[model samples]
Target: MPNATATPPAFRYQGWSLFSLLAALVLLMTVMILIINPDLTEGVRSAIRATARSSFVLFLLAFTASAFAVLVPSPLSKSLVRERRFIGLAFAFSHLIHAVLIYWYGQLNTEFWPGRTALGNVPGTVGYVFVLLLALTSFKSTTRLIGATAWKRLHTTGMWVLAAIFAYSNFKRIPMSDWYVLPFGLICAATAIRLMGKLAQANKRQSLQRVA
Candidate 1:
């Protein structure tokens, strides 16, 4: 008699794959924007802002996934948990485009890169550093190298830094245009959820300690 073995199921598309597809589509669209309007200075600046907005959306999705999944226990939120890393990577990719556009803007118009002392300049630069750190540590190898506790510390601090940067950047822009309110509100709401989640976690820890 011949021995039979069970074959594993074929690979299915899930969070990471979907995220890569979506990132590619966004990049294609951004490229098309430049094709349509060959004005590199203003056009690149517009693309940078738009890409930053999209990246913020992606970051929020990843940021809220785990907390919301536990809070609401829905398939969508849980799916977000599974794809959180992918979503984060997608955010990084979006921001990469944003960064490139910013550089292009600077090159196209020598005065485009504002002074570091300018309102958003310093914080934006800090935020990019955090983004790079987070992106580097998103992988299993880097996480292992950093150790679990250090990884948590780095990620937690980085998340808050990015959140504050987003909040400040949008809030500062409100004087220029009211359209900034949307992103500002979204970041604020996400920050609220994060705070609530932290409070809930602390309460649960206290309850567990009392029981023990």
Candidate 2:
């Protein structure tokens, strides 16, 4: 018989299974949004918005996973850290859908691309560039090719850049609608959590070194 004091193993969703599940959910949600809205252009726009929101959520999870694990030290937080890679990939997948819908929307609406200034597109374009680079380097083979140090630098930079982009994207929209404040506040809070986690880890390391 098992010892009564033994702890149960933490449940986790990992590998391709987690990615597939997340991707399927994003796809299903996008399809449902499109189907529910009868207008083709409006439906596509709504789908784009839906995918963007999904991408933001996945990005936050991946971005904060390590921090949460360090700060909270819970089974769920540990699972998130383990599953961070797949969750990041799912974010990439959702953003890819967002890109595709944007392109489709542009094709359907003649003024869509022309109406936007170059400056207005800069943030999103840079964000997508980082997303593509980060997604490409996510695999073992690619990470190995890049060297561990380089991979770490790239991912760290990419995540921060993406976070800033998200914050800016939402902040700029606040003028359009007050609802934008909620996401902006969320990003700010996530940033604070990550920063606190890093400080805690650094302090812990220093303490261990001093004791040793």
The best candidate in terms of TM-score: 2
Residues 1-212, model 2: lDDT tens digits? 88986434364457798999999999999989988998999999999988989999999999999899899988788888878899999999999999999999999899999999999999999999999999999999999999999999999999999999999999999999999999999999999999999999999999999999
Report every candidate's CA lDDT: 0.82, 0.93
Q: Give the TM-score of each candidate.
A: 0.87, 0.95
Superposed model 2: Cα runs more than 4 Å off: 1-12
* Candidate 1 TM-score versus the reference: 0.87
lDDT of candidate 1 over 101-147, digit per residue (tens): 88888788876665445754779889999999999999999999999
Best by lDDT: 2
TM-score of 2: 0.95
* Candidate 2 residue pairs in backbone clash: none
